[model samples]
Target: MCGLRKVTLREPYPDSRPKMRGTVTGGADAPVRACDVRFGSADRPQFRLKTIQESALAGAFGQTVLKQGIEIRDGQGRPMDGSSSPTVAALRAKCADGPAVFIAEDRDPNSKHTFVRQIFASYVEAEAERLDCEPLHFRMATRM
Candidate 1:
């Protein structure tokens, strides 16, 4: 378990003097001192999603629907085609109403699979279904 240690200043330093102007609110015996304290991280440290993954997630989804150029008359009274590219329909079909899926493919810098990929699908039936509104099987490559 992680815990913090109490710090106290025993006496005033040669250059620094205690300003004992007012009495202690709790009582006289209570120690009132200031000292520098440091804290470290606990065990089982969790990591954050890299910046590339985050950017790719938002950018990829945004670019998919925007490609069809077909206006969605639902929200904002304007076009709702905010998908980043054609792959948006396939992604939405696979995940259904489920959370977005982020797959990390480890590859060399020169290899093709060395990037973060995100796909959304709606798995309501037996297998993941691709939304049929448009054919969005395109991919948007994100730069490292």
Candidate 2:
């Protein structure tokens, strides 16, 4: 194997919090829409649940119309914002110049409901094309 422990199963972090996106700007002819994808389960389940939920959501919302990508970066394409999460920090350290989509899937232990919040960067279209997912319905959920 690649010595990589897949995050297939994870204990819900008690303090799991919602994430926010940074500033972004897209080129001409692009529609910026905020796509809020949320989900969660009551019982402790497998990681595939996330994938399943994502797939179903993509189906309902139409993947082609909802696919979105985001790249977390500092001003001037630098990595590591003062408010970046550990996931973001590690990503930057690994690939400084790489673009990253910061996805937050939050599961509430008591309610068993998960909230999937997606933050799309202004460059989501290009990135989504690279990933072959789909162009996202862009929106500003968090005010930067």
Candidate 3:
């Protein structure tokens, strides 16, 4: 038995990653997301309660559609004028060329407002860092 070695049930393999990782991305096309990572247990229960409330409201025809309720703001905390093309063009340049933060004039205007706030948040956050996530990469690259 001098040459024999025993393996235990809980021995972790050297190449295996732990259950948690330091960095993750919330890619739109992937099921794994940054929401799966967070600062605390804060959002989980709040989300469950919100889901229950939304479920109840669903039967009551839900809330009215938000029109003209969203405001776009800048780094100085002032509202951006959506009607000004020149101002928007400047924002596009400042946003590190992330997804068009504007409701593109060429794309259909329907339902796109639903995503406007979130897109701008990512746009601004990336702008501050001067980077964005793409696939497995943390750097921006020229489109193929």
Q: What TM-score fits each model?
A: 0.18, 0.20, 0.22
- Residue-level lDDT of model 1, residues 1-144, one tens digit each, is 001122122222223332212222333222221112112332321111111112224345544333443222322343333332222222222232332322112222332432122221111111212212332233333322
Report the candidate with higher lDDT, 2 versus 3. Answer: 2
Residue 60 lDDT in candidate 3: 35
Looking at model 1, residue 70 earns an lDDT score of: 27
How accurate locally is residue 25 in candidate 2, as Cα lDDT from 0 to 100? 32
Clash count of each predicted structure: 23, 12, 0
lDDT, each prediction: 0.24, 0.26, 0.23
lDDT of 3 by residue, 1-144 (tens): 001122111222123221222122343322111211111333321110000112222233211221132333454555543221211111222222332222211121322222222222333333334333221111111120
Model 1: how far residue 52 lies from native, Å: 18
lDDT, model 2, position 9 = 18
